[model samples]
Target: MVQPLSDERAPLEGVIEISTGALRGETRDGVARYLGVPYSAAPFGDRRFRLPAPVEPWEGVRDATAFGPTAPQSPYAGALGELLPTVAIPGDEILHVNIWAPSDAAGAPYPVMVWMHGGSLKHGSNALPGYDGATFARDGVVFVSVNYRLGAEGFSVLGGAPLNLGLHDQLAALRWVQAEIAAFGGDPRRVTVFGQSAGGATVAALAASPVAGEVMRQALVMSGPLEAKDPADAGRITALIARELGVEATRDAFAAVDPDRLVAAQAKVLAGSSPLGGGPAYAVAIDDDLVPVSPGDGLSAGASSNVPLVIGTTTEEYRLWLVPSGAVDRITRLHLAIGRRAAKISAAAVRRYRANRPGAKHGEVFGAILTDVLLRRSEYRAADARAAAGAPTWVYEFAWRSPVRELGAAHAVELGFVFDGLAGADSVALAGASAPQSLAAEMHGAWVAFATTGDPGWPKWSTERTVRVFGGAGGGATVVPAPRLDELQELGG
Candidate 1:
């Protein structure tokens, strides 16, 4: 139970009763916010590495004014820290949900959008200022942001433990929304689950998950990696981490390791590896029950056929990693060789990328290539699969180049525009002060439209392969045939 606020601030919004109990949400700028509402019990001690359990009922109104404890994570040091500022309020109740609703939404059912944050499934929290859902709430949507376990606590495939505990946390939160969001003026049947990076991948997994079972009506994946580590690869990662901790790769041994030490060891093991190698080292493990097959294959095989999807990636998604880590200038022929081998692309494909971007540096070329293989190609595969399954799919490419450091439409750049929060400090830092407001309005509107009506004002992705491009000279959006399809196909295969 949350301690009642002691400050003498004026009473904000009146209380509303939910399934668990009554909550008095604070009001801000015409939106009523119920922050830090626990959706699941604390995952610690015996519950560590186990599936999430339901939150127990509480007496009296609980205070939902402040942000809850963030999932324990290491700080985002150096360039990553500056680029992606994350808050680490260590606590056990990390599996919580925050809500933003229109003040006048009591009498009507609003389309619900549940946001899952991205941190490579390692580091991130919903408390980030950029994730504020007030704008969505004010726009007649019930917006929810959720927190789940991260890193070892969330993703480690321990013996005698459930796989994808973080994902299970997400599923539990969605169930909570279904059972409780109506009290907050949300339509449970119209839920749209959208996420970026790891969260985006989770959106894909949830769509393919048999256990999810109609929890979401639509899904939007932004720069989500579409592949999961092979079970053998996951075993290797588990063994490596276990060795680092000097413990057996089992639930009992890992649960005994200090969470802080375990996180540090996880970081140390991943350090100095290539982006592709590092990300998959801690990626979603393909499990028989949670994820029977890879999202791409499952979608192709008609999983989640009834759920419409809006999925795409930024034009320069890799710059987010390459530029920040200074890997852009450090690429060598050896690195390119490894990248080519991993992507299984031919020399002609490499030449095509180089020829397409004249005067590009080696690192830039390599970054672009990695971006296509790691991100764009996955999106294409998923989109293609959905199209083939006769499911409605809309594809987009964020092309708005940030004026700051030529970060040209890199990964996570489209987030601010999607949330209509270009003015946020984090967004401005990456997108520059002159980032287009009109473009944000358009992109945000499209997302809202998709959530409300399952259409983002574009033709479905079919054999024609049409895509909506957001960000041009005057910040206007245009539908054009997908670019570089031949090269992307070669890279994807």
Candidate 2:
């Protein structure tokens, strides 16, 4: 439970009164930090599987000093846990938002950037240390990170339940920011919603949502999948979970089941599932309410047509999954055949990829194909659609290889640099000890600049297919022609 402020007249150091109530924040290094501020009511018991409800009003100033309980998730086992640090405080108060603002607002309405963490839509929490927003605050921006439901609690497509509860949770958080961020010296009009991976996909989906209206002024999608799963696909996963749990795939049954048991059942069902080739068991569903169509198609049809966008993926996003798991060297012709079969791409498509990287190993070729099919191709399609619809779009590719483990600009590598959080050990593990500080400065500055103004210090992506490549072998960022345009076109980008 949130602690109420004492009635005794103590100095109000970092108190800000907003719509719900007053919040007392903590000050650190010239920045005001407010952690675990509830944006919506907890989705447990009677509210399970329902759309997010408004946060109930609270009395007095609530202490927002400590991180809130993260949504329930299965623990990451072994080295994966070390590589991606997650916070898993068990409790129901999971629909919370963390804010980092400059200590001295001075009546300036700073541009606001809302970050959505990525964990394939099943894992992840905002409490991760690397997601700390003090750097953005220090750089003259108000940064807000949110925690939403995950796994079965968030994405299971139960009968008679509202679909995409996690996305709805995000929309609720955005609404909260729009209504109340001004108290923290943030401009509600200058909001930029940005995220990587699943969060990135959420950003795109939100932009395409009919309810978005003028709520979001801009968006940035980093390594987020653009294609949403069909409703039938979501149903299959729900049925699979239901079969495993020995219950009906309905909201009442799921709500009655133990939450932990449901989470464990979801893990078991998804253990052998592959996210490649549109096989995500739990992801954004193509529900007409929140996501009316494929995000790519919506962008083409002028959904959020006025919202500018920054969209891109890492140069080798698949390496993050393949390299650490020792699956790269083990990939064989059978694996390629399976991937090709799943994606329904022709042998000519495989030949094109192989020709581009002459003498590449079958595993390397397989990883590249997955990277393009699952990430890069979708990014290109979304960007092209948005640009065609007259929304200014900036495209980029993070090409910096991790000096630590040859991770080669894998998915989520640019996160530390984006947040200007290279000092953290978790960050160093992915970015390497000798990661260039200059690149972080440049990339972070560009994000800030984009939030402030609708440009990211590069020419817009047009028919020229221009992209800003950050951190190549020589240790500097560059603006270059986008590689694999033909491959993307072949993949129907």
Q: What RMSD does model 1 have?
A: 2.8
Where model 2 places Cα greater than 4 Å from the true spot, the runs are 1-11, 277-280
**lDDT, residue 463, model 1:** 85
Q: Judging by lDDT against the true structure, name the best candidate.
A: 2
Compose the digit string of candidate 2's lDDT tens values, residues 59-142.
Answer: 777898999999988866554566777777878989999999988868469999999999978889999999999999998899
List TM-scores for all candidates, in order. Answer: 0.95, 0.96
lDDT by residue (tens digit), candidate 1, 87-186: 9786788999999998885546999999999988888989999999998987889999999999889988888888888998999999999999998889
Instruction: Show model 1 residue runs off by greater than 4 Å.
Output: 1-13, 277-280
lDDT (0 to 1) per candidate: 0.84, 0.85
Question: Worst ten-residue run, lDDT, model 2?
Answer: 272-281
